[model samples]
Target: MKLLHYTYRKLSLLLLLLMAAWGVLFYYAIIDEVMDETDDTLENYSEILINNALMDPSVLETEGTLMSFYKFRPISEEEAEDYDEKYYDSTVYIESEDEDEPVRVLKTVFRMPDGQYYELELMISILERDDMVEAILWYLGALFLLFLICTSIGTRLILQSVFRPLQRLLDWLQQIQPGKELPVLDNPTKIREFQQLGEAAVDMGNRSYKAYEEQKQFIENASHELQTPLAIVRGKVELLAENESMTEQQLKELDEIYATLGRAVRLNKSLLLLSRIENGQYTETEDVSVDEVLDELLPDLMDIYEGKKIHLVRIKGEEPFVIRCNLSLTQILVSNLVKNSLVHNHAGGELYIETTSSSLIIKNSGEHPLDGEKLFRRFYRSIDGKKDSTGLGLAIARSIAISASLSLTYKWQEGMHLFLLVKESEKKS
Candidate 1:
């Protein structure tokens, strides 16, 4: 979930809990206050009735009424001495409403002018107070609902506005590329924490860009510097080999030196190519078909390795297997993989190439499986090593595939070494 939504959900839950707690407390408080007021009204009516009975004892003979009811009964002296004023709630049958109605009742013991003791009961209706409480609850519920709705809308809008700068920062970060210049971040934020985060991100991008430039420059300079002396050394070795004064042993030594020099030159060139590919030097891209690449590469490869007597098997799907990548790098990637298969194959072995809409599978027959883990590492060679193999071919192929948003994986199955190159999207799916 987005941060704003997560925070809002938590806030909403907290608000709901608080509102519920407040509602419970307020409901009980209002009910208690209403009951207290009813009791006070009953007490006041009892006082008035007692005073009237003392003033004229004949008033006690009257019956109770609806709104205010009273009853007076004679009691023994002992009973009157033990009796005290008390209040309580009770239900009474109402002839008008034909239902039980709630009322507050007060009881007290008093002595008449004749010195005889009597018990008095006073009652007051609380039906109006119950209706008032219901109205209060309805009003409180409506207000709570309104407050919740307003808070939700206001919180969403406020959070969206507050996080706009972070969204802009994310957009800016998405556009950053390895070889491209760092983009200017224009998302201005007043929040101190977000401001610090934006500044740190910009600083990191600047440092990364600087490091990338320096690395690219170093690779180019080193390749250029090394190539010159290597060329001179090979030329001098060739010239020495042509001299007649060299004995048979010296001629063999010179031949070994020349072969070593040639290997060194090839290694240097391979390393330079790998560096250029990784540095994003081959950025020109187009929709290139793998089938077409194999068609052009196979004939030359077969001609070069004609002596191996390797059989070629091509499996083409109905739809073309096309990808968007640098044309030159695509050719190099295919060439290296195909060349590696041919170089490692035994005489009269088979080389299979399968192409589909989403992937390219290359399988070649070999005596044993290569290490899946180390096969793509630079300078990795098989146990049954070939002296002429530079071991950087598969590594370069993997690098090119990755840079072009493709997945290159190797597996050994059924005594055949397989290299599968598929689009990154297909791999994910």
Candidate 2:
């Protein structure tokens, strides 16, 4: 989830909980206040009736009147003494409505001037009050809903404005490349934390760019400096081998040294190529067909290993297997993979090359399977190592594939070793 949405969810939940708790409390408080007011009104009405009855006892004789609802009943002296004022809710039957309605009732003891004690029961209709309370509750609920909606909208707008700078920073970070200069961040903000984050990001990018430049320059200089010395050494060894008085033992030694120097030169060149590919130096790209590359590479490779009497088989799908990559790197990738197959194949073995619109597969008959895990590691030779093999061919192939956004995998099946290369886009599809 995005930061804004995540924050909003938590805030909304807390607000809802608070509103719910407040709503419950407000409901009870309103009801309690209304009940207290009703009780106070009932007490005042009872006092007024007692004062009127003391002035004229005829008012006590009137019962079941519209404005005055009360009943007077005679009580013993002991009963009047033990009586206490009581207030409660009850149902009363109204003849006009022909139904029962809720009311508040108050009971009290009053002594008449004739020395007789009586109980006074007074009731006030509360049906209208119940309706009023219901309306108030609904009004409160509506206000709560309106407040919730307004707060949600306001919070969303505020959060969006606050996070705009972070969004811009993310966009800037996406455009950063290993060899490219860092982009200028122009998102202005008043937030101190966001400003500090932007500064840290810019500093880190500059440091990374500097480190990358230094590493690339060092690799290029080292590779170039070693090339001349290696060539001179090999030339001297060749010249020494041609000496007329040199014995066979000495000549053989010179040849061995020359061969070792050749291997060193090849390893150095391979390492430099790998480094360049990783550094994004080969950026030029074009659509190249896998079938076309293999058509040219296999013929030359077959001629180089003709003494082994290998049979080459080609399987092409109806559609062409084409990909976008650096043309020179594509050629090197294909050459390395085919050369690896030929170098490890058994005598008079079969080499099968298959192509489809999405992938290329090469299977070669070998005496045994190569280690799948270590096959792509540089300087990893097979169990039965070849004298001329430098152990960098597959590693170089894998590096080229990665630079081209392709996947290269190795597997052993049946009695043959298989190398598969497929485009990442096609794999996803």
Candidate 3:
């Protein structure tokens, strides 16, 4: 997958491992301390029971009387046995009067002034000790569980907030399109690393967009500066080929060279126009009618339409369709669409150009169908197996439309090819 995907997975894993290690250490440390404290309390209880039993002779016969002197009083006789089994390994006491005997494993001996000796012995069981340990463990486990729940929720919320801006930057980068302005990066990140990442992404996008602007400017300037020189060369070639000494074959070759140069000049001019449109060089915020420009370009299209027996018609709305746009660029857009229809139409075909308040619809009768999606792509030709057409017409028109914030579309319907330019209302001045 992607590096970002791998990085996110590794970060999540690291967090989980760290939390697990922390929980383990905390459980053992805290629970062990608690268990040790409980054991100390039990040891003190054992000593008090032993001292009280030796002090009162009656306590020796009845273990119940020993409860008042014990560190922790047994709740019941049954409980007392279980408690003794948990705490003592074995208990025995030698009478103080019998000072000669050694102190044994679980016994302490006491002797009275009357020469009477009392011995108290008891053994602790593993099961009762395990019960105290288990209690400590359950307390630790519950606390750890609460800590884990809080940390998990906090981690997700923190990560999402930290990565939110980066996600926006990623989405913006993915949506980069030629001839469009970069979108603004709005969300803020406070973490130093994430802030730096966001800054880098914004800088990269801005740099790329600036570079594209510079490249477009260069192409437009180069195309404009080269035009005069190219025309001069074509003129010189024509003048030379007209010399009487040149043979018919020589003149024919000269004519072919002139034709190729003419095509090159046309291509350069179209490319220059497209560059101008993308740069917004031709934009003007003045009211103009789309219908008026078509009136002017239709006559220019007539010469090409002649002898093809094709019909070119214009349908205008009763109300003037006014828009704030560059008249020169709009003319270029409309002219390209009309010329494309004329060039691709079948013999004796009909072409229609209509303008409404909100749109301009151009249609032509033609057998050449194209993938409507690909029609606006630069250098895409509608007709297959056709070598005579320059494929930049639609692309150029689209650039102009986009520069003016207009939407253009293409489709085939009812045996006729269609192109539409949907006008957007002008922004308030």
TM-score of 3: 0.55
Positional deviation of residue 119's Cα in model 1 after best superposition, in angstroms: 5.3
Q: Model 3, 1-429: lDDT tens per residue?
A: 754556556766776677668767875786566556545654665567666765665555554222122222224334333443333243233355542222112333444446554444433222234565577568756866686677657766676666677787688778776556778777576678867887887798788878888898789689878898889989999898979999999999998888888878988988777777776666456777888887888987878678788887888888656656787777778888888888878789998888887788899997756798888888786544245556788898888777777888888888899998876543222
Worst 10 residues of 2 by lDDT: 60-69
Is candidate 1 or 2 superior in lDDT? 1
Measured on C-alpha atoms, candidate 1 has an lDDT of 0.90
> Which candidate number would show the highest lDDT if scored against the true structure?
1
> How close to the true structure is residue 117 of candidate 1, measured as C-alpha lDDT?
90
After superposing candidate 3 on the true structure, give the runs of residues whose Cα lies further than 4 Å from its correct spot: 1-189, 384-388, 424-429
Where model 2 places Cα greater than 4 Å from the true spot, the runs are: 45-145, 239-260, 305-312, 341-352, 363-392, 409-419
**Best of the candidates, TM-score:** 2
RMSD of each: 4.5, 4.5, 11.5
**Error in Å for residue 8 of model 2:** 3.2
What TM-score, to 2 decimals, does candidate 1 have?
0.77
Determine which window of 10 residues in candidate 3 has minimal summed lDDT.
Answer: 65-74
* C-alpha TM-score for every candidate: 0.77, 0.77, 0.55
- The whole-model lDDT of each prediction reads 0.90, 0.89, 0.69
Local error of candidate 2 at residue 143 (angstroms): 4.6
